[model samples]
Target chain A: MIIIAILIGCIVGALIGINAPVIPYTYSTFLAIAVVAALDSVFGGITSVLKKNFDLTIFISGFFCNSILSIALTYLGQKLNLDIYLAALVVFVGRMFTNLTIIRRYYIEKWTSKIEKDDKELQQ
Target chain B: MKIKIKKEKLVMSITIGIACFALMLVMFMQFNMVKQTDITGIETMRESELRLELSSWNEKYNELNTIYQETVGKSEEYKNERESYEKTYELLSKELEQLNKALGKTDVEGEGIVIQLTDKAGTQLSEDVKVKRITEEDLLIIVNQLFAAGAEAISINGHRVISTTSIFSIGEEFLKVNGERIVEPYVINAIGNPDYLKSTVSGKGGHVDALKELGHETSVDINKNIKIEKYEKELHTKYID
Candidate 1:
């Protein structure tokens, strides 16, 4: 049921985005960093749900806070000529990979255990 | 306990759904923005570097053209062995010079008039009426009028008016003459009888008067000596004899 809701939301969002007016070139960098942060939060949310530790308040706060922090870091990087966004990108993407591994293992173990149980029942 | 669990599950699904929607929307918008911009895959160079490269290329071209002209002139002089050949060479050279002058390949100087056209000040014009800036057609008409009044050579903004020259609007803000972009405060110089040229362009109901009526600043000055430079573009002909 949740999967179906997410799918519908994505389709509607894409349609609205396609028809929306574009933002200026100057702010595109900030938007890009924010997107990476948001993507990390989504993956983390999925992992927490699989582990039965999902909290709505924590998820929402993480989503907004991560994006804002990344944008601020990008601005500071520009002012300092340091390219600090590279550091943020590495951290976020690394965490995303870890969360992805956890989600993958959970689904794989569930499917394998179900198959094993069916085989034992057949023998009995 | 069962009903409460069901309500919690519903709330969780709704929250996730909203987050996913926002994420997809931003992603799609970013994608669209990237596609719309034309700078993809092209590295931008510093402005100074680009300018230096252009100037060097132009200098090289000018040096080569001068050398080529010198060599051609020497060959014509040395190859004329017979009286008949020498006479033919003399006639051909004269014809070439006249053709070059007519084609705007040679610089010209004489008495003429200079006409200046500029946009009206924004503060001077009434808010209801739009101020008129000079257009390509207006410049073309003025050039035609000068030629009709016996002007021999003409130039607009230092771009010599030649047989192949084209003046057209590039956009609302700029006009292109002989494929080079030019901006406002256009100065047109013509070489001919100064009195005749001024009378033709600045007379009653002429182009200058028309421009003034549309709220443009216009002026004409007669000069004893005006020089029009040779057209800088190389003329290419494929089908003509």
Candidate 2:
């Protein structure tokens, strides 16, 4: 699942890059990505607060990673003189790669095994 | 174990499907508006093209109109020039004939009278006391009085006075008559009704009195039976059109 997400991100980025100048909703695409990233970060924070196991390091790292990604994307736009849409899509691919490789491996494996078992039973 | 779809899932699915359908409807309306805009843009381009053509025609028409007016103005100017030239030619021809008669040898007899005016030497000067010399203005006044009295031909100090001539001072010690320089004690000779010219000069309130007031003497001599010589007038300046 993680690998599939990275592949999907790459495909989305390439497509957006190819249609760079023509995409009218490029701004909205970045907005949507930002909204989802913020929501995920907030939910994770809330869960940690409720459990009372909020290691300052873990809490800070999780938020910092996403914040760094957002800041890095903006920095890339300024440095490369890129359109905001192209920059956001490039950063999205980078985040997807990071997620599938290390961040979401445990969660994706756990969910994939369960999905496979369910599929086998349905087939049977 | 078999899983069944619940009521909440069914309601959520219906909500998502309705939202997607509404989004599609908006996209369709947007595409239709874009098409309408394209059509209107074509119409506007056609209208602009027509306006440009009309403006070109207007510019061309105005250019032609100006040309026509300038041509008419030039024609009127040429006509006035031609008419004036003809009138000047007639006047000059008459002057030439008179000059030829005056200069040409003539067995054919015609009558002319002469009047001579001489100033007394060293008279009682006027209040100005400026040597009491005769002036060009005085000669012009006497010549004009002779012509007014119907004198046909006139001369002053060997220079003939024509229809157009001016007698004036050029510098301190020199005066010009018909543009020729001369000195003082001017002798004026004119041919016409000598008796009439003599009366006109000696008449009451005449140039004779005016000259006397300016401290210069004047006289009129009539030569009726004298064998007069005719001479041609040589014009040195073009004074008239």
True contacts kept of each: 0.51, 0.00
lDDT of 2 by residue, B190-227 (tens): 66776787788767867866676665655556675434
Docking class of 1: acceptable
TM-score, prediction 2: 0.32
Off by over 4 Å in 1: A1-5, B1-11, B43-241
Q: List DockQ for all candidates.
A: 0.42, 0.02
List where candidate 2 sits over 4 angstroms from the true fold: A1-124, B1-99, B102-131, B225-241
Q: Rate residue B23 of model 2 by lDDT.
A: 31
For all predictions in the order shown, the interface RMSD in Å is 1.0, 12.8
User: What lDDT tens digits, residue by residue, belong to model 2 across residues A1-124?
Assistant: 3234334544554444343443232233333444334334434544454456544445445544654566467556646755453555555555545544543565677789999999999999
Candidate 1 per-residue lDDT, tens place, B190-219, comes to: 999888888888888578778878788889
User: What DockQ does model 2 achieve?
Assistant: 0.02
Of all true interface contacts, what fraction is found in model 1?
Answer: 0.51
